[model samples]
Structure formats: structure tokens, C-alpha cells
Target: MSDFSATGYQPVSVSDPEVAALVGQDLPEDAFREIRDILFTVKGFDLDSYKDRCIKRRIAARIRQLGFPHISGYVACLAAEPTEQLALLEALTIHVSQFFRNPTTFMVLEKKILPALLRTRPAGRELRLWSAGCAMGEEPYSLALLCDELCNSPEQITIYATDISNDILKKARQGRYEPHRVAEVPDSVLKRYFTLEEGFYRLNDRLRKRVRFFHNDILNDRPFHRVDLILCRNMLIYFSPPQQEHILKTFAAALVAGGYLVLGRSETMISETRELFECVNAAERIYRKKADDVKEDD
Candidate 1:
């Protein structure tokens, strides 16, 4: 059985080089297309937007779960076990978010990035923020609490929190959470922004009111443009280099010059997009958008 503790199913390291190499290594071309087509046409799930390695390994995991021998078998099995396709998608999305994840990163945002952004904003001008890949609402709510503490008027700050899953977005809209999910939250933040209900902590509407939750697919969906800082932490690891580059371009296009881009601690900008953003705090994965002298290519 998989490790299912407080963390739920503990996935085996998908980052292992050897494991990564196994992705799409032996799959037949026709079979691969069959699986992708089934996911797209029948299941209404688009696999092309995601990297092949990500799709293949996650599909392989589901194949193991169902005792299927290969992609061909898995594709056939999907007809009989329709729910299996959903199981594959749930596996692929990879939600590991928690409140105040990576304390050092948030510390940098609070002390450096937010301060700089505030200083630049004209008085009464709204400071905008977007939390991409905001899973179950912990990250966005954490940002909300931080804004409450840092901003002179929390109402002046507007936050957009987006995730790809409608199921996940529904839970985010509720703003309710279990204790273990909030274990990393500070006592002060908890006392101020949350109301304890039974055993779980319910985030106050005051905090929730500041943020707008919605569903967005980072790859193909229309990216939010203009404004200020964007936090896309721990999300690029699931994408291919090309996908990562496309995402970086999207972020660059979205942020105003001098606006900040905060990525996951493990993620970084490649040489291909170095000119897009200047590194502000390398260790904290904070980058400031470099002024675009030329109009961005469509």
C-alpha cells in the first residue's frame, strides 16, 4: 500500500533521473496517441498542453495501479473503468500546497518584494497579486493574512487565486480547513484571520473577501496581464522545459516592469528566458521583470 498518513498518498519521487528516463521510453507511437486522444475526445481532458514526460510517468503510475501492462492496455481499460481516466488526471495535477509553504520564500516576499511593490504604487492605487496553482486555498489565504499584516489597508490589495481543478476551486471558495493543513501557519495569523470551528479552522470572510478564486489552466488559458506580483511556486517542476519557457513568457507578459515573479524554491529561469526577468533574490526565487523596450511578440 502507498504511504497514507497526514500527507495522504506519498508519491514516489518523480524527479529521479532514472524514473524520468522511463517516461515515454518504450511506448508505441500509435498507443501514445490513442491514450492522448481518449483523454481529450472522450474524457474532455487535454494532454497536449502538458509535457510528454509528465503525462507518461503519471499515466504509468495509474497503469501500475490497475495492473495494466502498457499504454495499449491502459487505453482499453479506460473504456471499462471510466473512472480510471479521472484517477489518472488526479494523479497528474500534483497538489502539495500548504499554508506558508517555504517560510524563507514568504519572508523574502514580506520583507523585500511586497515592500518594494508598495513603495512604487501611487497612494490609493490597488496593489494586485495572483497566486497561480493555489491548491485548496491555503496559499492564497496565507497571502491574504500577510496582506492584512503588511498593507496599510488590506482592502486596497486585490488577489486572484486560480487552480486548474474545479473540484479544488469549490473547496477553496468555502475557505474551511483541517488542523494539519494549517500546522505551519503562525499563531498570530491564526488568531486574527481564522475562527476555529469544532476541530477545523474556518478562515474569516474578511480574509476571504480580499481574494477571488477561479479556475485557470496555465498552459492554454488566457493569462492575466498587467498589474503587479505573481507567485507561481512549485508548479514548473511538473512541466517540460518548453512548457516552462512558455509559462515564463506568459508571466513576463503579465507583470508590469519592476513587478516581481516568485517561483518555487526548486524552480528557476533557464538561459532561454534570462533577459525576460532580472533575478532579485536568487535564493528566494524572486525575480523582477526587466523593462521591455520592444513590444512582446504575439
Candidate 2:
């Protein structure tokens, strides 16, 4: 998941000395475990899967803001107040995304990947794509726009977008975005596909209808099957190595043989999963699932 900031809360840096000091204080291990259990019981969020330093630092920042001197106090607050739990979950999991987030990655997809995949597709078959961790619908809508332009018929493509937060999924289904969220979008595309409403740019029904938004937790939920492409960007960095491998293996299983996987610019395929996929473009962090006929490395 990408970094999230609630209203009135400044973003916390993991390396900040203040956060370090807070975490370094009399925070007992059991208290931390209690906090994790409370979060799981209330929100179903597996805090243990996240990198300890990052999650702890974010919690520490919240603790600092709420004027709690220790982790125990915050644990009590979380157990007593459901609203605080949701606010913390939002702070932890919410991501702000834009249309065509990384131009270069989309350029690679448009110029190279899409053309190649379409050429190899059998006639009468639809191209399937999944945007995992799609926040606010921008990522999937961006894919829909690209597929719409490339394919001869809109029905020739299917786009599935999922997020863990039901509240975010509801917003994503609306297919509405602020102007800044669409700043990267070309003016021509903006005019053709979206309507300028009172203030927000509302996606036209054509593109809006193209995407299917759902609530999915990649960790515990079953993945979509036989997908042609999967875009899960900037999400793995927050997880521990084992959790990262688990998610990557899930992605690998979901993709068809020779299907593509595109990750965030900063993410890389972990060593444990390197045998499952072959790197296609290192610069853009694109990879292709190895065909079944290929043998794994010793």
C-alpha cells in the first residue's frame, strides 16, 4: 500500500528521530502484541505481515498525535473506540493514486507490451487485466482507457480492480476524480472520456462501465484466475519478506503462462519468487510468468 495521511495528520517518516524515540521507549513486547491482536480482531488487518519498523513508526506517529505516552494507552483507545480503529486503518492502508501514475511504465505498456500481447492473442478472445490494490479507481480506469484505445471493440477487453477497504471500493465504483488526480491525463483524453462537472471530472459512462470494482484482500482472498496482466504497484514495500513472497506467488499463480506482471518502479521480484517469473524489463520492473515447460533453477 502507498503512504496514507488522514486529515489533520502529517505524514510520518520511518526514520524520524521522534518516532524512533517513541518506539524506543518503555514499549513492552506484549503491549505491541496486544495492539496487533486488537487490530486483527477489530479490522482483520494482519499487522504482523507489515514491516515492523514502518507499522510501528506510523502507530507511533498516531500515538504522538493523540498524546499517549505509551503503546498501552493507545491499545486501550483502539479497543474502546471503533472509529479510532477505522481511522488508523485508513491511515495505514489508504493510497492516493493518479491517472497513468507512471508515464514511462504506461508508455512501455502502450508501445511494447500491449502490442505484443494483442498480436499473440487468438481471435475472439478477450484480454483480461487486474489492477490489484486499486485506490480510488484511477489505476484500473487508466487501464480501461488504454485498452479502449488499443482494441477494436470495447468488449474485447476486461478490467478488474480491487482494494481491501470497502469504503475506498465504494468511492472507486463512483468513477469520479478531482482535477489534480487527472492532471497527468492528456487534454484530448480528458475531453473525450471524461465530463467536467461542477468541479470534479466525472468519467463518462463508457469508460466507467468498463471497470469492475470489488473489495479484495490479496493476503487472504483468492486471486483472479488466468489473467493476462496484473498491475500491483508500490504495495509490496510495506510487507515483510515472507508476506511479499506469498503475495508474489499468489500473483504468479493467477497469471496465465507467459502473462505479464508489472510492479511499482521501486519494487523488485524477491529471490524466493525469482524462479517463478522472468524479468522482461528491469528498468520498468516488468516480468513475464515462465511457461510450464520451463524448468526451475537448482
Candidate 3:
């Protein structure tokens, strides 16, 4: 029901049952193979093991609005042109992000975790953090603000924020925000960190320079550098269980021994991989990597 249409795309109609029926139709095994090819060619997302039903539901909603009822037609649309593929990929890859999305979790980071990380860091060392799936850059900027408040020189901290969407990454690097996006940001921090211009907020140079933005696919690529904390946030919810497990193992590999992993409020480690990470702040979904674990992929 949320307005999800992003640049040059129409919003999919959300009359529940109609959307359900279109998705409920039986899809051939070959249908997914075709889908994986189109997705990879167009958006570079490999959807081979991605849960078909969940994808079909999203596809059906888009198809219904576009007046196509059959999955074949949807595939045709994807094959017809590159633009359609871009639009479909934008819709398929979920981009629901907000400033300081989980306040309690952020509070724990600001009040406790960061201070502890700073204390144990070797002399004159800088902290490195990665905001995986950092859609539109709010989370990394928020971390920059926190680092500014916590560290004597915020420039000492470095945050790498990445997302698969080239479109979102462009917007993120611009560092501009709609006014409403800052609703949860504290007034003191807001005024200190951003300058208002033309009905939007622009992140100041200090905070902006501390964060670097890049394109990363968690499932396919190596994480950047050793990190003190990695904030993957809400992205795990959309992936299939096996995909989730694959990514978590990558996350564990990316972190230094005893480094932190943060997830969205609704996500948890798959039961099978519990031994790889131990919870630190259970309610905030904060975890620390197991010192004894080694990557099988390595």
C-alpha cells in the first residue's frame, strides 16, 4: 500500500485478492530460469535461488497494474527493452529506508556499543564501519553524526555505505534529503549536521566526507576492508533462507573477530547458523561474531 513507484514507474495497484490471484497461478520451473536470466542481464541480480512465490507476488502486482495477467507477458516486457528491466528491478529490489529507522537500536549504538569500540581500539587507530544495503545513505550519515558526537574528530571514522541500485547510490552520494526524512533525528544534531536549503536538508561537508558510497552485492562480492561494525539492517528479510545464510556467512567473514552485526527489528539469525554469532543486545538485534569461526568459502 505504500507508494513504491520510483522514477519513471507507475505504482502497482494493491487490491489484495486480485493481486493474490495473479501471483497464485502456477509458474513453470523454466519460468524462474528465464526470470534469472532477465534479471541478471537487466539489473545484475541473480534470482536463481530467490523464493519464487515472494518474487511472483511482487511481479504479479506490477503486472496487474500494467494490464498483463500472464508471467510470459511479463517476461516479454523484460525482453522487449532495457528500460522495462530497470523499472522492474527497481520495484523488485526493496528500498524501504528511513533516518534512524530503529531509534532504540541507534540509542544503544550511541550510548554503549560505540564507546566500547572506541575504548578497545589500538592507539591512534580509526574505526571502520560498513552500512551494507545503505539505501539513499541515511544510515551512514546518521552514523557519521554519531561519530561526530562521540569522537573528538569525526573525520577519524570511516563508513562505507553500499547498495546494489545505481539509482539509489547516486541519490545517496548527493547527500540531499526531503524534510520529512529527518523527523526522528534530534533537533540539536539536525541543526549541527545539516543545512536547510530549498525545502530539503543537505548533509554538511564534515559528515559527507567521512562516508564513502559504493555498489556492492552481498551475495556475490567480498565486503570492503575489516570493519568494527557492519549494519546490514532490513535487507535480510527479502532474501530466501539459503541466500540469507550465504550472506550471513559473508558478513561473519567481513567482520573482525568480535565485531558487531546489526539487523532489522524483525530479522534474526537462521537457527542453523546460531553458532557463528552470539547476541549482544538481543532487543536491538545486535550481534558479535564468534572468534572461533572460519569461513568455508575462504
Task: State TM-scores per candidate.
Answer: 0.76, 0.79, 0.79
**CA deviation > 4 Å runs, candidate 3:** 1-73, 77-86, 295-298
lDDT of 2 at 221: 89
- For model 1, residues 1-298, the per-residue Cα lDDT tens digits are 6433543333455465433433434444565577778766655555665644656656666665554434555678776676776666677786777888888888887887788888889878898899999988888888888888898788888899998777788988888888888999989878877899988899998888888998887877877767599999987876667878888888888887778899988899986689888898988889988887324334
**In model 1, what is the error at residue 162, expressed in angstroms?**
0.9
Worst 10 residues of 3 by lDDT: 2-11
Q: What TM-score quantifies how close candidate 3 is to the native fold?
A: 0.79
**Candidate 2 structure, TM-score to reference:** 0.79
lDDT of 3 by residue, 186-281 (tens): 898888888999999998886788889988877677777568899999888767677788888888878888889999887899956688999998
Q: Model 2, stretches more than 4 Å misplaced?
A: 1-33, 37-87, 293-298
Candidate 2 per-residue C-alpha lDDT over 75-108 given as tens digits, one digit per residue, 9 for 90 to 100 = 8889999988877887777477999998899999
lDDT winner between 1 and 2, please give it: 2
**Candidate 2 residue 251 C-alpha distance from true site, Å:** 0.6
